[model samples]
Target: MRKEKLKVLLVEDDRIEVLKLQRSIAKDLDNYELTLATNGKEAFERIEEDMPNLILLDLNMPDTNGIEFMQIMKGRDELLHIPVIILTTSNNERDIHECYKLGIAGYVIKPLKYEDYEAKIKAIFRYWSLNEFLNY
Candidate 1:
């Protein structure tokens, strides 16, 4: 039996970051379908149309930030269940604490090295693939 591809919605504002993530997903992960959103507002709209199995969120954006996005999702039944993993540069203690309070599955700090970043992304996908999720 063939396994279904995991749908992933990535919310990030930086074009370079988006491209890097896209490339990393293509190179490291198998059986994943990615959807991109530049900000929280766009992500919310995308989620409304079709919810993904997982969300990769960035903390800071020009429009709505990750915390705001999580808050919005928390109120909605359809979106509340989707696992969000924060992949961001910020390592602020307050941000980390707040994200956990907001119900993120995992918080990953983006690495400076390209190889390290790719490895981290691969690991996240691998772990999630093995784990059973009710919503997916």
Candidate 2:
């Protein structure tokens, strides 16, 4: 049997961070289909249009942040099942604890080094690829 590409939606406000993620996973086309949403509002729109297999969210966005986004998802039946993994600069315990409370698959603190970030991204894909997911 052939493996399906993982459809991922990244929600972030920082243009640089978006670029970094793009660059990090640029070579994994066979394994991933990446989509971007600059903020929570756009993320919602994207999800409504094409639900992703996973969500890569940032904690500090304008208007609606990661935590708020998760809260909204928790309230919605259709959106609640998609896994969300936080990729952010925040290392605060409160942030980590809160994200877990809201049901996140993983929380990764963005490393200062690009190599480390890339490695983390690759590792994340490797880990998630082990699970079976429903195709949308």
Indicate which candidate wins on lDDT.
2
Error of 1 at 112 (Å): 0.5
What are the lDDT scores of the predictions, listed in order? 0.86, 0.89
- The sequence of per-residue lDDT tens digits that candidate 1 reaches over residues 1-136 is 2167677899999998888877777864567778889999899888878778889999999788999989988988877788999999999999999999999999999999999998898888777666678234
Cα RMSD to the true fold for all candidates:
1.8, 1.5
Q: Highest TM-score, which number?
A: 2
Q: Which parts of model 2 are misplaced by more than 4 Å?
A: 134-136
Q: Each model's TM-score, in the order given?
A: 0.92, 0.93
